[model samples]
Target: MTPLRQRMLEDMSIRNLATNTQMSYVQQVAAYAKYFRRPPQELGPEDIRTYQLYLLETRKLAPSSIGLATGALRFLYKVTLKQPWAVEEIPMPKRPFKLPVILSREEVMHFLEAVSSLKHRTLLTAIYAAGLRVSEATHLKITDIDSQRMMLRVDQGKGQKDRYVMLSPRLLDTLRLYWKAARPTLWLFPGDLPDQPITRDAVGQACQKAHRASGIAKPITPHSLRHAFATHLLEAGTNVRTIQLLLGHRSLATTSRYLKVASSTVCATTSPFDLLPKVEEPPPLTPTPPAHF
Candidate 1:
């Protein structure tokens, strides 16, 4: 790696950014440099603006993608190069507000059952059972399973925070069966290399195949299971603050979004009209005299 890249990596490490975040930042910066065919340090605000336009007009990247690229460029200039220009010059694109697609309990069951691979099925099941992100699920170790406490410890989840989520009795049974069959030594789901955990892409591929086999019309990704988990809990009457803690969301607003998608929660809610007093029907109006016309 070049000296500049090494320094940027060190800066990210010092701030304790998540591994996935660091990787994304590095990749985005590299892509930005390649686009201009010049070092990022030499580029200025005008180049960044042009590059943002290129991402929007030419590459047609999603707002989230452009935002990530912009963040990387901002870090490269402000943190790495120590540029005097204000970081706000690198404006992030506005991401559209789209509600997450939630699957009903039956749909979730059908999707999980369609997964053919035992390991993949177990991993996906655990994610739905505990409301875990793909990265957190993939990085799970054998010791993380606390059967006695009926909880699973999520280490270094998003934002580099550790937390515990409930372990359903049914899920524990499924995991026990998987453990006996696979006998994972270190990682709960070890990859082909043994030392490393299973890749998120592998889980994603499994979800894709399962979605096809299940014949579900709605999209089914690993994150979809997590969405279903949160919505289902909300429908079951779990409080937003509690769910926020369970999901490791820094903001309660993030967890409350599930309320919009929770069908039962939305439907079961009492409407304002229902609370209004009942009124008898009024008499039919008589025709008004028009003799003056």
Candidate 2:
């Protein structure tokens, strides 16, 4: 069992999975083993399928939860156990399509203004300004900001891919002020502990507090700021491919969802009724046609 755990960790490390992902997968696999009261290696495809059903039907788990468990089990069987056929019978649940919640520009400003702590405010603003995930913002280093290039280097972003995002002059100035005030030694947004980066929970709590204070009503969150960022860029006429690159999205489809959130795209053309001039019905035209006939 210990050897199996070691192999799984090594494989995850090689794939450069994020720390949070690694922990989640580890926990999922452990839970599977505990459920069966035996090592995961001893479980067959039938057992895996049964457990998934139990999660969905009896436990009333969400599709996302089932997906995560399926992924972790698949990785264990295929990657760690070197048994690709073991998970053949397990099926992935269909995830429902839902549009991401986005905040208006004014709401975003209010949310930021409601944040009382300089560190928290700056960090959330950076996430929105740079279109960064909370993890990416938390892990940012001082050297990552390139004012000359007008880009911010996001090292080891989602899927362990490093990419560059545009830097707004406004955001850069705000960051400068934040840096001077915070005087963080290493991580740009270091936590109270010297060496540790700020936890995602802390960022989330700040967002929740800000949301309550602002009373914006819309479901505002840290990620909603990111959605607002992308949507605003699309509204400003930034192309989809360019946004894909900026947001570090691997697929064009993922970035294209911003089209739904962008007001410009939806509001570009006026209704046909509004284009026509108001006039009384042309009853005279009918009588004129009969006379010509």
Give the candidate number with the greatest lDDT. 1
In model 1, where do residues sit more than 4 Å from their true spots?
269-293
Q: What do the candidate models score in CA lDDT, each in turn?
A: 0.93, 0.89
What does candidate 1's lDDT look like per residue over 1-293, in tens digits? 98889999999999888888899999999998898999887889999999999999999989999999988888888988988783868887888999988899999999999999999999999999999999999999999999999999999999988999999999999999999999999999999889999998899998999999999999889999999999988888889899999999999989888988887767887999999999989999999988884
Clash count (model 1, backbone only): 0
Give candidate 2's whole-model lDDT: 0.89
Clashing pairs in 2: none
Candidate 2 residues 152-202, lDDT tens each?
999999988999998999999999999999888788899879799999999
Q: Which ten residues in a row have the lowest lDDT in candidate 1?
A: 84-93
Which structure among the candidates has the greatest TM-score? 1
Candidate 1 has which clashing residue pairs, if any?
none
